[model samples]
Target: MNILRSPPVPFTDQASVSERRSNLLDASTISPAGFAWLMLGISVSMMLCGSVTFFIGFMLMPWVIGLLMVFYVAGIVSAISLLGRSIICNALAPPSPRKHIPDNCFFCSSLGFDN
Candidate 1:
């Protein structure tokens, strides 16, 4: 009933298969010197990145401080300006009128109080 014949698969015993896998794993394992070199490369790259970031932060510190200082001065100036305007407005505005009572007031006489 087969239209096309397929190649036969080779059978392997459990012991031989395990032995071959172990040999492959042993061959692929890294040597001590290679591990040391890998660690050295990683450390050098990390140190370079750290130094670059530190330099960038150091360079930008002055600008950041100056911006904060500008904002603080602007806030102080705005507060002082508002205070001055309030004082000037109050000084220029007319005084509130005061109530005057006549010396011979009828209300006081009716209340039996002598002026």
Candidate 2:
């Protein structure tokens, strides 16, 4: 016996109108909390490393301690800047606009239009 296979349907045909629209809108949205957390974790790690280096430098040579201090200060500055930028971006992102279209629009009934 021979088996027959059908061609795959395109994406537009696989989902309802509402679902497709919702997916498009969701794709454009960014997770602000996730960004903030990632920056915070990286900054903390940098500070921890700087502290360890400073201790090691103090044990080896007093002059090396100054270099480590600079490293520590730079790390702190970077952390503060990243955190401030993340907060500002989260605050400034505008709310998602509503999708509107007349029933008579050419692509209103189908997901064939590209914005």
Candidate 3:
């Protein structure tokens, strides 16, 4: 089902590399300090929630709740790792799932490709 859609514009490759680079998620767009701080905050919050939930489960003596919290913690941790990896992949050269990128672009060039 579609609603309130705008017309699609034609894709063009004639834009300079610098311009296309903005369209892509390159290292230039991220602040490493921000990334580290975000991860740290996520880790701290996850630990706090997991510990509190586990403590409650222990006090209540429900074995299943403890197990559920464990799984929840694991799921969030994995999700965060995956999201981070995907973001990093975007910043990497030879960015993910793009067609018609030059064979001599930064990604290939950084990986030691020469022609």
Which prediction has the highest TM-score against the true structure? 1
Computed on alpha carbons, the lDDT of every model, listed in order, comes to 0.79, 0.73, 0.73
For residues 32-85, what per-residue lDDT tens digits would candidate 2 score against the true structure?
776677678889999999999998877889667778999999999999999999
Each prediction's TM-score versus the true structure: 0.60, 0.31, 0.33
Which sections of candidate 1 miss by over 4 Å? 1-16, 95-115
Q: Tell me how far the alpha carbon of residue 107 in candidate 2 is from the true structure, in angstroms, after superposition.
A: 26
Let me know the TM-score candidate 3 reaches against the reference structure. 0.33
Where does the lowest 10-residue lDDT sum fall in candidate 1?
1-10
lDDT of 1 by residue, 5-64 (tens): 332333655557667766555556667787788789889999999999999999999999
Pitting candidate 1 against candidate 3, the one with the higher TM-score is: 1
TM-score of 2: 0.31
Ranking by lDDT: 1, 3, 2
Against the true structure, whose lDDT is highest? 1
Deviating ranges (above 4 Å) for candidate 2: 1-60, 97-115
